[model samples]
Target: MPLPTGSSQPVYYVGWDVGGWNCDANPASRDALVVLDDALNLVGTPWRGNLRTTLNEARDSRDLIDRLLGLCRHQAQGAEHVVMAIDTPLALPRALLALARGDAVSALGRSQENPYLYRETERWLFQRGITPLSPIKDMIGSQATKGMHLLARFAPHIAACGQWLSDDRTLTVVEGYPSPAKRSPAFAALRQRVNMPATLETMLHQPTPKQQDIQDAWLCALLAWSLRHAAQSVAWPPDSMPAEEGWIFVPVDSLTPPV
Candidate 1:
């Protein structure tokens, strides 16, 4: 489908979280998107859906990415400067790429090197003109590791989307938190500081398997909005930020799963 066209806006951003049973799954199982205005308020309900297939087939990831891009294009039909933050790694640093090609398990180990590799991979994407954010640096500490179960299944889909997209500058993929702890301090702090509406409570209470994906998507969308308007901090550098990168949106998250 063609991207929607309408009145122009100062900035538009979309955040995404791709869900799957494994990194190598044929099709992504669940996905979420959040659309936001330049102000960064909750502009709309987070767009939640699934790919309707598995990522097992080689073409599965490609098809899923097309659908995802379509969703972003459709949602942000009128805005200028679209930014996306995804919950998967967009690009691998050369070192980790070598390890991934060698023993995947060894690279997946919960070690400083592993996360450094991941961070470097993200920085590499930034240098290449792709806006890639590392949720690990923002949320999880260095020692934390991504669960193999999750990474092995989802990584391929993320990789596929990164490879298929031609303009890395326009397509941003950011690592995001997989799931938030219920009633946790972080959740409360986010709500209190952001003044998130009560409607989001329902999302937190829902029992759906994709709850985490939905919430994270919303958060990514918020970041996208911030990137457009907010100045850079040490934690969030303007040049490294997704908004500075491109027009399309994607959300990524560190592999660290919630305990």
Candidate 2:
């Protein structure tokens, strides 16, 4: 489970579980974030809050970046590459966009191939028995838009179907879906193999929404790590998928539902 890096500099994996823009109104909701080093060690205590407050307090874009980085708490200060995996839809379905622009869309009969709601990546998940929430169909538009806002300010350069790299190439942002992974036997085995930290283990047993957010954040961080080092463990989007409709990186073993 130890990830060896080719670069001498350390790589940090971040997981963000996006919530509504204003978490103050919702007691159970929180935008949780967790950080892990290449070695799978927790970098800092998990942070549970909204970015709206941080944005309102920031002086400028640079200051906002610093504020966002500060959430990493003990993240190493020196040369580092950060890959942030977010649990939310990063882009809208292409067909949904076309429909929005007053176009006729077909293929509405089947649940999996519905072009207006599910993206290619989402359909891929459906074929594998993992049901994904549509940003348009589901009521998670707030969460999805919040994730997009984060991508806008941090990593706006799309490198592929599901990835966005920063201007200086120091940061990479990718979409992550942790619900399936959280239920996978493979992930349970992985937790045992990696010797998941005590704090994270404790978070898993708690039934509260706040704790769930933290657990998902940790899983997303692990997804980022797998994308970097254990690529085989990740289900990457196929080339045929459109770049406009981003991909969701899920654990390979999570493709099949647990019986």
Clashes of each: 31, 0
44-98: candidate 2 lDDT, tens digit per residue:
6788888777856755434444555687676345456778899999998888888
Q: How close is candidate 2 to the true structure, as a TM-score?
A: 0.88
With a 3 Å backbone cut-off (N, CA, C), the pairs that clash in candidate 2 are none
Model 1 C-alpha lDDT per residue in residues 134-214, reported as the tens digit of each score: 434443221123222222343322322222121322233334333322223433443344434677767744535546667
Model 2 regions lying over 4 Å from their true place: 1-5, 55-66, 75-78, 193-200, 205-207, 257-259
* Candidate 1 worst ten-residue window by lDDT: 141-150
Error of 1 at 203 (Å): 1.8
Highest TM-score against the true fold, candidate: 2
What RMSD, rounded to one decimal, does every model reach? 10.6, 3.4
The local lDDT score (0 to 100) that residue 119 gets in candidate 1 is 54
